[model samples]
Target: MVAEEKTEGQAAPELAAETAGRRMVVLEDFKPVAFLDDDDRASAVRRYSTLFVVDGRTRKGGLGRVLYAENAWGDRLAVKVLTAEEGADLTEEEQQALASRREAAFRREYESSRLLTGIAGFPTLFGQGRIDGQPALIMEWVEGQTLEEARRRLSVDDDGRLSPLVAAAIGRDLFDLLSRMELVDGGLVHRDISPSNVMIRTQRASVEEQAAQGKFDLVLVDFGSTVLPARASSLTVRYGAPQGATPDYAAPEMLTADVARVADMRKSPAVDVYAAASVVYLLLCGRPPFQLGGSSTGGEGAEVASDYLRKTTELPLPVRAAHGESADVTVALDREGEAVAAVRKALADERLSPSNQDLKEALVCVDKRVGEVVLAALEPDQRHRPSAAEMREGLAGFVEAYPANVVAALQGEPLFQDWSFDERRKAGGFEARRRAGARLARWAAVVVALGLGCAAAALCSGVRVTAVGSLPCSLEWGFPLVAALALAPAAAGYLVRWRGGRKRSGLVRGSVALAVVAVAVEAFVLSATVDPAAMKGLLGAAPLACSSAAWCGMVLEYSMSAPSAWATAKRPAQGVSGKGGSV
Candidate 1:
């Protein structure tokens, strides 16, 4: 009813591919082996630090193969490959462009896969490398049943329904992770978390122990499809306005299906909440709320039409109509008792979540084992989400309090993060380059100045200076060149910086420009002066300008750390070590 019924809008991204002959980095360690076995034929496997078998087809029917590697300790993990083969069928120029893209994709995957190992409830990275020369990263093999499988087992129809309580626990746990992620790292977004990503294990809770205990582990996998950007719209790729996760589990924003028109898809952490809510809905009712078509594993639409958008409602089957699998949702989303179009829009449009109350009440109906402490985290506002450490603590405490009746969710939090590691690293790298450039620029100025002096002493003496109308100005030919020399660095630094990131603030940019201006002016006046001794003295001070720029760079380096000892540490290093170190 929302239009554009298909969940995934665009076609899947093309696989990267190149010809055998043009591939400069040839497959060196080519070997062969079988998948599940004692005996097998020689299947050409690309080997570097690991093995690459780009057979393409996967167990789930995906377009990739397993990358095997052993780390320093020789621990093995599976790196799910995203093939370049989709591009193999392209033209020459396209192939060349794809080579660069594949490299970036590899780097992004490696870095993101490595970073995610820090968060809780995620897979671990064993190793990564170029096998047969193609880049790959090895990681832990998550062995469990996807939530989709669990849904099929529990749901009355393929339109999986989950009780609200189960949905809340899922929501709370995910929110907790997101908060920790915000504080820890900011580079990777698990862009493709769907029912398939959520692994579920079932345990028997007998009739006597109706609400006895539920113990389970949820592992989020498949970084292969992740959007590994420094920053992105939490709304779009991860979550559409209503639906941040996947269309099936997507919130109302995703339901509306209007967001496709907006080129720059952007959303927030709550974007995931919608999908999270959908997951909760599935857990409570054994099926998702809205039924666009069916479970993403490929179910028919009419059966899953009941996968209602969050806080949305259709017809709750009467108690008389109830069967073992039949369930009801009083999740009448609008206080206004709005019309069909309005409700659809609300479910599909970007929601302005003011509080967690709505999501919280929805969860209360599911299970009692869920803690209020964790539920307290399900607030619609992202900042309010409990930190991963805090969530871990809460989940741990709940188990301690309700040991007999509760089981843990995920075993450990990912160590891949704690704070903005990428941000800090990027900021540090930028500051270092700028300082080095400024230093080099300053060194260049000095070299040019010394060169001019040497040239003047040796070459200019013979070149007759026709005394102009003003004899005083005749002595100033060297001054113009000095200004040009000194100004170039800051200019070049600015030029080198096409666009400043969070680290390069306006104040810093302006300050660097001013330092360049001030130095150039002073160098010009000093170089052209009539008094030779004054020029020598002033030239010695010119290095101070370089030192000044270097000091600013150091301050930026330390400032990103927000260090109290920065001022004390900065002056000694930048001004002293590299001040005249290069010049």
Candidate 2:
């Protein structure tokens, strides 16, 4: 009733001939299609006299085909046609049944579009009709590239990731939209929230204004798979109604066909929360946090299934058995329930592959609070996930912390603003890089202290008494004694560093011990062969030795721990801090 009824004797509508292996319904240009007035059964019908198809604008999806078109008055629009060719191997009766199912889905999409008529960020419905005996729905043509394209562009510089600030901004926008959907009567759930289903559109402003503001709008498209909570039982809970979602982004509850759990979750916003957080995670970490167990052999659904079992139990279903097979209802439901529970528990415990701990470490490198908010949204237990409003508030904190001008500039091509690992290191955010610098500075200071200590020791011992008015000096005791003196400062520095609560590396302690023992042995041999009176010169070097030792101790302690200590200065009281006191 949403479209005009077909009348007998209407000439066979023009349709493009089907190409081999491509299930597309490419319509010829200038084909006439009829759209009914908004009233469900309005007798008045608006016939599109000259609908011209835009070349190179056709997009094929599993459910249907989308294409761009214009009418007689040159009003541009997007047309979605419910047409797909069943496998050639199917009998005529099977093909007819499949066609009927697709037609029903098409009508449901039209109903969803009508329900979402006034929501911001959603497409405006133009009309609905039949073309060449296939169902078609026309809507406002949104001009923009898919989020997938934007993500790909931003990932060019950072191992397939975007900056934390950028991801936060986008995430805020998505949650804001989801919050709006929650307010809709009966509540709506976008079961499919993949990157391709989102659009990034620049505002209709001048190029100069765009460059100045760098603002972009996010649009949630593809309502065909969207569902209202009340109607979910008739769809997903019904056996044989395949879940309409990309396996990678689908939540754990959605991975299995557990009727009770799936039915109960239909109204929960947490389902979309998991998906949105996964998208944000993908942007931040360059990969999904969970690895599909049997992805190599079975599809993603099976991989998630195997991933769940592998985490929860020693034995897992064979890739083939999990893939799909005709089974009795009782057995199937039991399997589905177990899988759903296992996945939920595994995810709740943060036991999935590429563990949450690792993800947190990676995220903390960028911004700790941002990581906290994202992980909370990814909480496996629905009760733990923050409400939509809470998620928006959490993300808004970091998004607002960023300068508007910088965000605008970064949104442009080439991503003028970036937060790669090297850039973060330069900003003093990378712990490893800071540690490397500290190590170099510490070693250099130790070497300098050693050289100075040896020189001072040599100067003190080389002086000698001589005939009245003649100044006399001797260099004979310098080699062995000075060598011992140099090792003394290094050993003292190591002790001070170790005493400051710094865990000493084996290498540092070993090097200091080896140098001291070796130098002491040589000094003893030389002293046994030389004058015993030369040892008296050491008394004169006492002040210099003490001062050099103090300096070495301070330098080594501070330099060795400065990197981590300085980075965590603003952290909580219980956080790890530098135990080495400042000079």
User: Clashes in candidate 1: how many?
Assistant: 57
Best by TM-score: 2
> What is the per-residue lDDT of model 2 for residues 309-374, given as tens digits with 9 covering 90 to 100?
432243211111111221332332232332123222323343333333433332233254466667
C-alpha TM-score for every candidate = 0.39, 0.52
**Residue 548 displacement in candidate 1 (angstroms):** 39
lDDT, model 2, position 4: 26
Best by lDDT: 2
Candidate 2 differs from the real structure by a C-alpha RMSD in angstroms, to one decimal, of: 27.7
How far out, in Å, is residue 422 in model 1?
A: 37
Weakest lDDT window of 10 consecutive positions for candidate 1: 403-412
* Model 1 Cα RMSD, 1 decimal: 19.3
